[model samples]
Target: MCGIVGAVSQKDIVPILIEGLKRLEYRGYDSCGVAVHQDGQLRRARSTSRVAELQDLAAQDGVAAGTGIAHTRWATHGAPAVHNAHPHFSHGPGVDAPQGPGRVALVHNGIIENHDELRAELKAHGYVFLSQTDTEVIAHLVDLLYQGDLLDAVQQAVARLKGAYAIAVFHRDEPHRVIGAREGSPLVLGVGRDEHAGAFFLASDAMALAGVTDQIVYLEEGDVVDLQLGRYWITARGEVTGRFQSVVREVRTVHAHSGAAELGPYRHYMQKEIFEQPVAIANTLDAVTGISPELFGDGAYRVFKDIDNVLILACGTSYYAGSTAKYWLESIAKIPTSVEIASEYRYRDSVPNPRTLVVTISQSGETADTLAALKHARSLGMLHTMTVCNVSTSAMVRECALSFITRAGAEIGVASTKAFTTQLVGLFLLTLALAQTRGHLTEEQEAEHLKALRHLPVAVQAVLALEPQVIAWSEEFARKENALFLGRGLHYPIALEGALKLKEISYIHAEAYPAGELKHGPLALVTAQMPVVTVAPNDALLEKLKSNMQEVRARGGELFVFADGDTRIESEPGLHVIRMPEHYGALSPILHVVPLQLLAYHTACARGTDVDKPRNLAKSVTVE
Candidate 1:
């Protein structure tokens, strides 16, 4: 979970790298540094706060540079100190090389899974390393592998390396060119006319390159780019490959930008994102007409149709989304579905085999654990691998045999608001596609489902209007340190995600349980001091959730209920009820999840936490 950017230009590139790093700091802010080659000398600086401070220093009047690489790091190997920051350098072969003129520096994203082995190999070659970071291993490895050609050295080093990585390296000899490679993490190339007028930039994401220059080149998973003085292109080794070009869209329309001035005037990104639910849902519905039953390919029907069992793999919030999706995949598709956390899926002795349809969910395309699981499943010879992801051209999408794109737009909030709901929308649509293919749902049923799906946006709007209510509810939870969320059937997973969101941002010890599981264990945690947030959508499980709420009430625990308008479920003495608009079938979960998200967001805000950048968490986990 780090950010890397590189630029090759015929003119000074200090300003460009500095601005790019500021935009990219959201990816990682623990530590940052830059390496720029100027006047036949390579200069570097690193710091721990934000990228702007040192970057501002790097762009001094006389600090003219033609080529440079920058990185904002999220620590994995060492602590988040200046020493562990990216643009890590070594004179000759180690970090403490005595500040010499001739030196090499490297910036990296993703993990070097076999760095220990590589480090031992480098040490055997008499390459003394300084830093404790796994990244230092790569820097030395590149030096050992560097014979004459810089591009070839990077290529050979990457070939010998194991696991996921996006790397940018700079050397004194090859000061005019910036070399970059991507395996699991994202790397996009920004193109310009020439170095004088235009330059090519390599960044972790499209947003980092926004407004600088939009002419973009997207790198394929195994492809590497060589950005020389005047031109750049991707290559597998020496063979050039075609680049994936995309248009740059404005960050937001002028009206949406101005209207969302305070981000809906919410206190934090979490709260703002909560209020964005109605628009997010509306956009999802507006963009999707209906998935052509054959959206994947010709054999899609054969793989998806008449499935006997299903397996779902994902990490974090996406895993919770999968948990809720299991209910619909089983009930609607009439298929037995088992949900597995991606990190643990392959490690366990399990059999998904050839019959099961494995679906993976991820907000960003590059979740390290989830990607590892995807690769392991591929090796197991699982033929049908599908994904539901927000990123269009992520590693996960490229690897999956079939995929659905979630149109949630950019989710800057690390705690994830729209990503969860958009995933639900995609999964619900997938269920409909599978049911129709399996002959479980008729034309009338499909039509009714679509009609209900169309109304989801309106239902979400109903929930959005209750923000003042949620804001008021936030006060009651200000002093709370623990909470329990309960739901049954379709919403069981929603409860889990709700609890996860609250704990993620608020640092509250929250646990979620299927209302059915309460009698078994979780009920023991309920007390007058603990708040119980229950998703009580009016459905087959509504009565069951109602009974569970009574169980919580019996223990004198506080209750916060979100139910449909007609359920007539009123708030009990220590309980509070927030009513939702009516929607039937699979659509309710998508609507029901909106309020729970808001509750967690408001609670976190009331408790005064860094809602955007939560403690000890990364927006995307690029290393397992």
Candidate 2:
């Protein structure tokens, strides 16, 4: 994933562009750069480093302009180098200029499928490519098509593109003008208000434009927007005519979390997000007075009643949340549920039933694979669709018939913490709603579940209190290169999430397996050097999980267990136990995952790894 922020404002846009890139850093990037129209010429500075470094470089170069475009790139077509970084330029016919600052400056967020063909065509037209990037091809094409108007050139350039892209382009000749277009990627137009009324902005997310603007226009598929100092215009592609026409898009007021992105007391965003879970869960469930289908959407009751089975589709941590919900839906709602990875589901053949409700789970809601899978399921006649998403204005919410918006605030860490737990809260609510519709949830059962839901925030707070103990465990874990996680029943998905967190942040080779499968194969890999972490709840699987713990100990493998209070598992040689304050019954997974997050965070800290921006990972997966 990449981030784009462009602005046409009266003030010095360099600071705005750099600050916007800083806010977008959670999305992940390898290199960053900014291009500005300064004194009748294009001035830019790029670096293969963090956005903070790029900011310093821009300041050192005195790169200031009232109109500019900035980019934080996670490389796809080229290596992570200064030349491959964006705000790529095309010098056009003036290839022999002193520094070749170029005429067109462009920043792109997605991929170009036919860049090879376009690169060949541009080379034939005497356009030289400096950077080895698909984005460079677009810049050349835009410069080649420029016939005096920047907007027209960008529109014509995008018309020839063959894949997903969201681009912000500016021409040096066109002062105070920036043109943006989105096809498959996400783009938003921020209309500045009050003191900043004369400014206009385009960003990959509304978070990038926080404080500067609260009003956002989410560009639809194939929409092009031209931003000027005081005004903006939008044009949408006609489906039948295949031509762009002027259109009016709704500008919705968005209250972005301007302060949440900051790291206050915590060492990293991952640590801050882990500690923020209790508040995040409370905010996500703030509107729940009682469980009802209307908690999802207007026609959720009708959709729940009509569906026979549930099909859950998601990617990464969202998929694991879906996996946990499968147990809840089957046991509580008496509905057969199947969870599928969105990327694989979209490319494979599957039986899609119209009576089966397809539920999509995503934090950003703009996850490209999950969005494509939702459409694929629709193509197979699965009409009933629902989404558990964090962003209310995301494409997934707009595409689904029903949605539960999680109020996880802004998850700045590349490794998700609060967002994963909040998604489980949404999914559990969906399960209760479906159970009510199916006559499985009685009045008494509903009341008890509601009470548990109300106490969840406090339960999570207690779990967070165990961070000191988890930190001690992390010190030992930091020395190991491999880890194994185990769980049974509903907590098995929690184990998977724990392993994922450790691997993602700490760069350890971690694997998760159902405890029952240990004897079959995983036992061979258990040794004194390997750390086996287990989620041992006081449920029916407790005895079986104890037996699996014995299996690990017999193989000389050290065990770290997160056990419930009632479980008599004590801390002894070769075994370490961290007891829970109480047993949460059905909602135990949410509480159990907190310490695992702490373990990963502290372990990454001990190892001196990048806890917030882990290597080769991004917070939001907007591309397939």
Candidate 3:
């Protein structure tokens, strides 16, 4: 995953490129670079440092070009170094000769799967490469194919390439234009006008162009775009191979203010988002006086009635949310449901049902694997697609037939907090809506569920008050090397998420199992040295979960339990218990997860780990 931003305007665009890169740093932050066309040549600055450092380097280098492209790279092909940073350059055919300046600068996101083959071919042509990045091959390929038109050269070069990419390239000779293309990765155009003249920008996401422009045009797959001062055109693959046709598309305005990455009065974004659960849940259900299929989108009722089953595709934290919803969709809605890891779902030779509703979950809504899985499902004749996402302008929302936007604003933490919980809220609402459509939910049942949903904010607030208790447990957990989490029924997925958080941020080895499966194998791993965390929600499976806890205690394993108020589990010797304020039925996972998040956050603090931006992780998986 990487970030790409390009600009073409009458004014100097170096600042715009740098600012946009700052907003996009969450997508990638391994290294950064910017290249601007100046003095009839390409002037560039690259650093194996943060965007702030790159900005300083650019200023020191005085890279004042009217047109430019910038990149924040997450190393995919090589180690993170200055040479591996983006804004890769390619000199013209006269690179070996002393001639006029002819150079091209390019920045790319996604992988070039066939770069080794292309690089060997380019090396035979006497091209010299300075970096070990696949992106460098693209610059040389475009340079060799340049026949006067930059857009045409990019189109031809990309056609011969393989694998996913969203790239932007600009030549020193053609300083007024930037050529961009997308195959499997995301790229968008921001259309704007200033006092002096019109401007156009290209970025991997809209957050990069927050205050720059609100109007955006999402480039489609296999699309090439030409961006010049005031105008841009998208070219799609035509009827025949290698043939292209230009088409016009509508520019949609988005709420740019909603995606602002502001950390207001909080030590870390994860903490801020954890505490914002109340507001995030309230805002996600805002204006929802009652739950109905129409709450998703227009004509959602028709799709709900027609679908016979549900198929959920997601990855990482989103996948756990889907698994948790599977319990709800089947038990409450009486609908058969299957949750599949997005990356693996498409590769398998499974049967696709047209009557099955495909539901995708993502926070950024730009997750590459999930998006590909959704497209694969659609191609297999499943047209009833829906998404639970945070960003309204994301491609997942645009591609789906119906969508429910989660009001979790700007989750900048690498380890997701609010986004995951809000997605659960949205998925739960979908389950109730489907149940009502299927006549499984009576009017009284609907009112009861709605009442619980309305009180969710208060429930979450109460759970957050247990942060001090979680912090106390974190001190002991910080010294532990291994942990095992246990839960049952709907809370099983919650146990998995808790384990994931602990390993993701604190770097503690952790595993989770449905409490019933502990005796099969995990019981052997329990010992005095290993701490066992249990999600003891006071539900139908509470007694069974308690038996699992006893199994752990029999092995001399210390127990840390977040149990509901009604649960009679007491804190005693070798048994640590923190009582949850209450057990909010059917929505207990949302409340139970808050303590787990705080535990991970505080344990990471105790262990001196970077909680907000975990090591070797990216916030959004935009590249597969």
Candidate 4:
């Protein structure tokens, strides 16, 4: 995943581009660069460093321009270096075009799958490449096609591309405009004060243009947009067939906050997001004054009535949320449920049911694999599609027939704390809606569920109070190299999430298993050196979970347990237990995960690792 920001303004845009890149840094990138048209030529500065470093480099090089494009690149075709950094340029096809030196400068996101073939063709046409990136080919290709009209040349050049990409192109010959195109990738346009009197902006996400401008337009797939100093237009294209058609779409305002992502009192975004769960959950449920099918979207009741089963598609943390929802769906709604890792689901052949309600869960909602999987499911005639996502303008929300927008704000942490919890909140609502529609939920059951939902924020706050205890446990955890987490019944997915949080932030090798699965070979790895963390909720499976804990204890394994107060698990010499003040029953996973998040946060702090922006991790997985 990479981030792109471009602007055409009358004012110097170097600082604006740098600030935009800093905001989009959570998208994850190895190097940063910026290119601007100034002094009748193109000026650029690139760095194999953070955006701040790139800012300093640009300032040192005295590079400033009013109209420019910036990029924060996550290496795809080549290793991370100055040469591979974006804002790549191309002169043209011939020696005379090379003398121009700044015929084209472009910043691109996503992989060009057919770049190798295009590279060979361009090389044969006397085009020389300066970077080992698939993106550089676009610069040359656009340059070769440029005959004066930048937007038309860009449209023609992108017509030859395959795979996902969101790019902003700048041509020295047409310095007044910035051309942006997206196919299977995310792109947005920002409208300034006026259509013809102010600057126009283009970025991969609204976050990049948040403080700069709140009026945002999300570009659909195969849409090429033009951003001029005071005017902009969009041309929507179709890649389904070989022929391309262009149509203009409307501009929509994005309700986003540039300040919400600030760490404020917290040291890291993970911690801030962890503490924000109470607020996030409340916001996610705020629209549900009383649960109904409309809470998801209009006509959701129709989709629920027609569906006989549920198929959830997601990846990583979102997948775990879906996995947790499977228990709620089958038990409450009486609907058979299946959860699939989106990446694996698309590649494998499986039985398809037209009556299956396909639900996709994602934080960013632009996850490439999950989006592809949704399309794959659609192609199989499963038309009932719904998404539980935080970002409202994301492709998942736009492409789905229905959607529930989670108000998790902005999750800047790469490990994902609040987003996961908020997703569970949305999924629980969906479960209740389906159950109510099927008459599976009685009046009393509905009222009780509503009360529990209303009290979830308070329950999560109570769990956050146990942070000091969890932090104490984390001190010992930081000394370990491997970990195993255990949970029973509905909480098994929570155990998996705990293990994921540990490994993702602390870099410790961790694994999770259903408590009953200990006899199936995971127990063999349980030694004194390996710490076993167990989720002991006061549910029907508490007795069985105790038995599993006993198995681990018998193996001389150190045990760290997060147990409900009524679980009857006392702390002993070899057995460590952090008691949950209350038993949250069906919604226990939302409460149980808070301490695990604190554990991961403190453990990462103890290990001096980057808790918020972990190594080799991006907050948004825009690519497969």
Candidate 5:
């Protein structure tokens, strides 16, 4: 996982490149560097720190470059260091190039799974390398086989590439053009007001290009593009080509959808997103009003007419949403639904039939595995593919047959909060649609469900009022080195998600187990020194959960219980009750989840971790 940006501009491009990298920080990086060709020489700065020392160094006076390439690297092939940073360059590979600098420089993203084999081959050809990165191997390989044309040489080298990558390549002779290509990861070209006066910008996320310009053209898999300031040339893998239609029209996403944001008043994006949950939930419900007649109301009762099964594929928080939706789909829609990790789903040989609908959930709509799943299922002739996504114009939305856009605006945090809730809202709507399609719901029952759906935003608002209480609880976890979360029924999945959030950002060893399974195994890990958060809302499993609580208490374990307002969880001894709004049942997970999100957020914030960007995690997993 790495973030890359390159620009060929008439003006000095160092400032623009650094600004782009700062926005793409969510992609997670151990080290970052930026390289610009200044005064006919390639100059760069890099470091490993939260301070972005590389950008600071490059921003000083006398640093002037018209063309540059920048990278925020997540270490995979080498230790984080100045030497191993990107813009990997090579000249002494084999025979010198017929043209250019006898060397090539490139910034890459994604793992070249066969890099070891490729390196060994090049080494035998007398190509020596300086860095341990797989990317370094590419630079040498390209140079070893270099011909007169740089674009052809790049395509030749890429033909040997085995895994995912998005790269920005430049040569000393071809100083004005930055050639880019992608097989799985993301790359875009940002054009400015005066065409050639603009820059060729490439990044893993659109946010990287947001400040400089709002216009962009995204690259498709197998598409190679050659760019100068104002012009872009598209080509196929082997032959020169161009897209039949431009990325969009002259209008700014005129025929597209987008999320609005208010970044003016928050200390951190996570805090702002947490406060936006209510509106986000409402936005998801509002979208249902425009659902196809065949998918909503009485007219939409035939698509699931004979459907008997469902599959949900997602990653990270979206996968947890799938887990919660499974509970609802089985109970409300009476459909046998299976929740799957997107990476595992495609690798398996199992295929869905025409009667089965596949749902993909993602916040950015660019998750690599989830997109693969959608492709794999559709390739097997399952045209019934739908996506619940936050970004309206993401690749997933464009690829899926049906789409549900989540209302959660800009979720800058690596650990999702509002996106999780909004996805659940979309999933619930899909479940109700399935029920209507299967003829399992009468008009009155549908109305009742609609009313319940309308109440969710209010419920979420009520949940938000508990932030002060959740903040108080953060103290116990701020210094915690390990934690355990337990729940049963629908809330069991929420427990897993809560633990995952803590682990992802806080680097705590957190585990989640079904309350009933505590005695079977996890109980052994429980101790007075460990914090065990139990989700014990007054649902059907409340009494059974109480039994599990008793066992923990008997084991001298510390407990943090989140329960309904009227529930009888005692605050005596070592127990603490995080009281919920009221007697919540199946929907309690959505409400109960807010506190845990807050807990993890504050814990990471208190620890002074980059709660928004985190480590080794991109907001959008554009590459697998």
Candidate 6:
């Protein structure tokens, strides 16, 4: 995934572009660049380093302009290098001419699937290629298609293209003008406020335009936008006609969490997010005074009654959240549930049921694979769709029939903490809603669940108070290269999430299995060097999980367990126990996961890894 930010303004926009890129740093990037129309010439600066380095380079090069496009590229078609960085230039048929500011400069996000064919076609027209990026082909294509109007050129260029992409382009001659388009990938238009009024911006995420603008228009699929000083217009590809038509997309006032992006009292965003879970969960549940199906949407009750089973589509951490929900949905709601990895679900042939409710989970809700899977499900006649997402204006929320917006705010950390926990809270509420609709929940049970949900903030705060204990355990875990996590029943997915968190941030190799399956295979990997992390909640399977812990101990494996205070799991030789404040029954996963997140965070800190921006990962998977 990559980050794109463009500005059309009366003031010098170099700083705004750099600041927007900085806000998007959490989206993960290897190379960054910015191009601007300056003094009747296209001036640009690029670096194969962080945005800060690119900012310095821009300052040193004195690259400043009121209209510009910038990008933080995560390598796709080419290796991470200065030549491969974005803001690609098209010199325009000057194959042998001296290097000069010629025509167009463009930045793109997502892959151009037919770039090779397009590149070959452009080469025949004497448009020399400079970089090994698909984005470069787009720039040269726009240059060749420029008949005068930059908007027309971009439209023609995109017409010849294939694959998912969001692009922003500005021509050398078209001053104070930027043209942006979105096919399958995400792009938004930010209308500036106060003193910055009359300025318009384009960004991949609303977070990129935070503080600069609160009014945002989420560009839909196959939409093109043209932005000038104080005006903008949009055109959308018609569904049946396959032709672009003028359309109006709703603009919503969103308060992007610019303050949340700041790491004030914490060392990293991951650490800050881990500590923000209590408030995040509380805010997510703030709208609910009592359990009701309407919590999802206006007609959720009818949809819930019509659905016979639940099909959850998601990827990565969100997928694991869905896996955890499968237990709650089936056991508590008496509904058959299936969790499918979004990338895999669309390719396989399977029987589809119209009565099945398709629920998609995503933190950013712009995840390309999940969005594609949602569309695939809709194509199969499963039109009853819902999304449990953080961003209210995300594509997932807009496409789904119903949505429950989480209050996790802006999760900057690549390894999710608050987002995952908040999603579980939302899924839990969904389970209760379905249970009530199915007549499996009584009024007393509903009140009980509601009370527990209300107290989640306090319960999570207790778990967070154990951060010191987790930090102590992190010292031992930092030295470990391999780990094994074990749990049973409802807690198994939490163990998997723990293992995922450990591997994601600490760069440690970790695996998780149900406690009952330990002797089946995973026990073979247990040794004195292997550290076993167990989620030992005081549930029905506690005794069985204790037996699994003993199997590890007998193999000389060191054990680190997060257990309930009443579980009576004491600390001993080769066995380290951290007692939880209370046994939270059904909500134990939310509490148990907090300490595991802390362990991963502190272990990454101990090993001096990039806890916020893990290598080879991005906060939002906007590309497949």
Looking at model 6, how many pairs of residues clash?
0
Q: Per-residue alpha-carbon lDDT of model 3 for 1-624, expressed as tens digits?
A: 589999988888899999988888766468999988898888889998788998899999898877899998887888999988988888754463312333888999888999999999988887888889999999999999998899989989999989889999998778789999998888998898554248899999888888888888989888899988877899988867658889787798865663447878888778888999999999998878897999899999999999999999999999999999999999999999999999999899999999999999999888989999999999999999999999998889989999999998888888888999999999999999999999999999999999999999999999999888889999999999999998899999999999999999999999999999999998999889999999998898888888988889889989999999899999999999999999888999999988999999999999999787677788888778
Given candidate 1, what's the lDDT at residue 498? 86
> Would you list the C-alpha lDDT of every candidate in the order shown?
0.77, 0.93, 0.90, 0.90, 0.77, 0.92
lDDT of 5 by residue, 174-198 (tens): 6767778787777766666544355
Candidate 2: segments with Cα more than 4 A from true spot: 93-99
Top candidate when judged by lDDT against the true structure: 2
Predicted candidate 2 versus true structure: per-residue lDDT over 222-295, tens digit per residue: 89999998889999878899888899999999988889888998888888888889899999999999999999
TM-score of candidate 3 relative to the true fold: 0.97
Q: Which residue pairs show collisions in model 3?
A: none
Worst 10 residues of 6 by lDDT: 93-102
| Candidate 3 stretches greater than 4 Å from native | 93-102, 240-242
Runs off by more than 4 Å, candidate 5: 50-52, 94-102, 194-198, 238-265, 290-303, 349-352
Clashing pairs in 1: none
Off by over 4 Å in 4: 93-100, 194-196, 238-246
Q: Is candidate 2 or candidate 6 better by lDDT?
A: 2
Q: Write the residue-wise lDDT of candidate 6 on 507-565 in tens digits.
A: 99999999899999988999989999999999889998899888999999899999999
lDDT of 5 at 575: 94
- Weakest lDDT window of 10 consecutive positions for candidate 3: 93-102
For all candidates, the clash counts are 0, 0, 0, 0, 3, 0
Query: Lowest-lDDT window of 10 residues in candidate 1?
Result: 250-259
Estimate the TM-score of every prediction: 0.90, 0.98, 0.97, 0.97, 0.91, 0.98
